[model samples]
Target: MAKTIFITGASRGFGKIWAEAFLKRGDKVVATARNTTSLNDLVEQYGDAILPLQLDVNDRAAGFAAVKQAQQKFGSIDVLINNAGYGLFGTIEETSEQEARDQIETNVFGLLWLTQAVLPVMRQQGHGHIIQISSVLGVATLPVLGVYNASKFAVEGLSETLAAEVAGFGIKVTLVEPNGFSTDWAGASAAQSQTMPEYDGVKAAFQAGLTDDSFGKPEATTPAILKLVDAENPPLRLFLGKVALPWVKQVYANRLATWEEWADVATAAHGH
Candidate 1:
């Protein structure tokens, strides 16, 4: 059965790869980017199977309009891939307030507004899947990328609540937490900050570890995503890349150990 998949940030990287994969599988795709011209290749190759739209996901109005256009063009939006987000690379002190807010505006808030716009269509149809592209740092912490981590953490929290609230309505929400991938995340697309000399050590370590082949390629991740979309009972959270599962497990272990060690303090705080 061919389903309609609506994807944001489809100009390049993960979004573009996913859009192409879906189209190849005979799915109708509503592919959106900040600049529609970037979708020309997809349009030329996929033809009518792909509807390319110009959209800045940060604007609520644009999100609504895009959803409306998808509905008009395809009759229903069966799946939504919230992939329009960027990372901000810097320590909190190195990052300006405006920079932090702009990061959130597109990453955290944009996902919400777009999901809000698409919720109605999914509700009316009584079935849909919302896939939020988060990151491994969403649950764990990394030095110098605090703001980016915060944004993805917000996505993590929001998607969990969305899934619980909409499960009764036959709607599903999945948060995709990916490890470092061979995308432009740390290169052209990431919003980099002025170097803070104090964080030089952290920066050096990160750069030294990130070899060319260290990052997972976009095509390698497509099969896992396809499986999720095809599953009858998809997970509420899906972590991509070989590095994600083990690292996240260690994070959870540390978190649980810390919480257990502080259980007495937490219970005492109740003052009962």
Candidate 2:
């Protein structure tokens, strides 16, 4: 049976790859990007199996309109993939307030808008899946990418709650956490903030080390997404890539250690 899938940020990287993969599998895909023209090739190749639209995720109205259009064309959307987001790199002090807001706008609020826009339709249908393309940085953190990290962390928190909230309606929410890969994310899509001389060495070394960190192919993740779509019972969160598990585990261990160290004081404020 073929399902109708709607994906945001389909212009390139994982989004474009996944859209083509779904179409290849005989599924209907409503693929969207800020620049709709980028999807022209996919539409020309797949014809009716693919519907490409221009969507600026920061616009709530556009998100709603996109969902409405998908429903009108496909009857129902079995899956919604929120894959539109970018990375902002810089020291917190060096990043302007607007920069921080813009980072959150696309990476956090954009996701929220799209998710909210699709929720009603999914609920009405009684069964659907919402796949959130979060980052391993959401679980862990890096110095220069604080704002980006915060945005993904927000995705993690909201997705977990969303999964539990919609469980009764048969709406599944899964957060996909992937570590580094060969994607547009590290190229033109990424924003570099004004440099802070204090952090020059750190930034330079990080940039140099970036070359060897490719853990997997961004398109290879399409299989994982497909698996989740077909899963009768899916996990609330999935960590992808060779480094995802170890990196996440280390972050958890640090958290546990801190919590244990402060357990007595942390619990002292409240009296039973």
Candidate 3:
């Protein structure tokens, strides 16, 4: 059965890749981007299977309007993929207030607005899937990506809470945590803070850690995502690349050790 999927940030990267995949599979996709002109090729190729809408996800009112338009055209949105976010590259102290605010606005608030817009539509239909495009950094930290990490962490928390809140309505929420991908996310699409001399070494070390092998091909993810959405029961969180799980395991292990090491101190603070 073909589903009507609403995807944000469909102009490029994973969004564009996944949009085409869905369309090729005979599904209906309501694809959105900041500039509709960028979606012209997909619109021409896919014809009416794709509905190209110009949407800056940061605009709350526009998000709701887009949802309304999608609902009006497709009748029901079977899936809502929140993929409109960018990487903010900078250390904590080096990150400017405006940078932090813009990051949160696009990643956190933009997601919230769209999710809210779709909830009512989904609830009425009695079934829907919400896929949030988070990152591995949401669960663990990486140097020089403090603002980006924080934004994704917020997404993780919000989506998890939303999953619980909407399950009774037959709505499913899944957080798609992808590691490094061969996309413009860390390149052209990313926003960087002004360079600080003190954090140069940290930035260099971070850049050095990223090798060609670290990134997964964006096209390869289409099958995984298709299977995910079509499953009878989808996971609350899905890691897209090879590096995420093992790294997350180590992070959790370290967290567990630290908590255990401080268990006595925590118990003393409780003071029964």
Ranking by TM-score: 3, 1, 2
Off by over 4 Å in 1: 211-213
Q: What's the true lDDT of residue 65 in model 2?
A: 95
Over 150-219, each residue of candidate 3 has an lDDT whose tens digit, in order, gives 9999999999999999999999999999999999998999998988899878878888998898999998
Off by over 4 Å in 3: none
lDDT of 3 at 158: 98
Error of 2 at 241 (Å): 0.3
Pairs of residues clashing in candidate 1 = none
Error of 3 at 79 (Å): 0.1
Among these predictions, the greatest TM-score belongs to: 3
Residue runs of model 2 more than 4 Å from their true location after superposition: 208-214
Question: CA shift at 13, candidate 2, in angstroms?
Answer: 0.3
What is the TM-score of each predicted model, taking all chains together?
Answer: 0.97, 0.96, 0.99
Compose the digit string of candidate 1's lDDT tens values, residues 1-272. 99999999999899999999999999999999989898898899989999999999888998999999999999999999999999899988999989999999999999999999999999999999999999998989788889999999899999999999999999999999998898887888888889879889988997787666557988999999899998888999888888888888898999999999999999999999
Clashes of each: 0, 0, 0
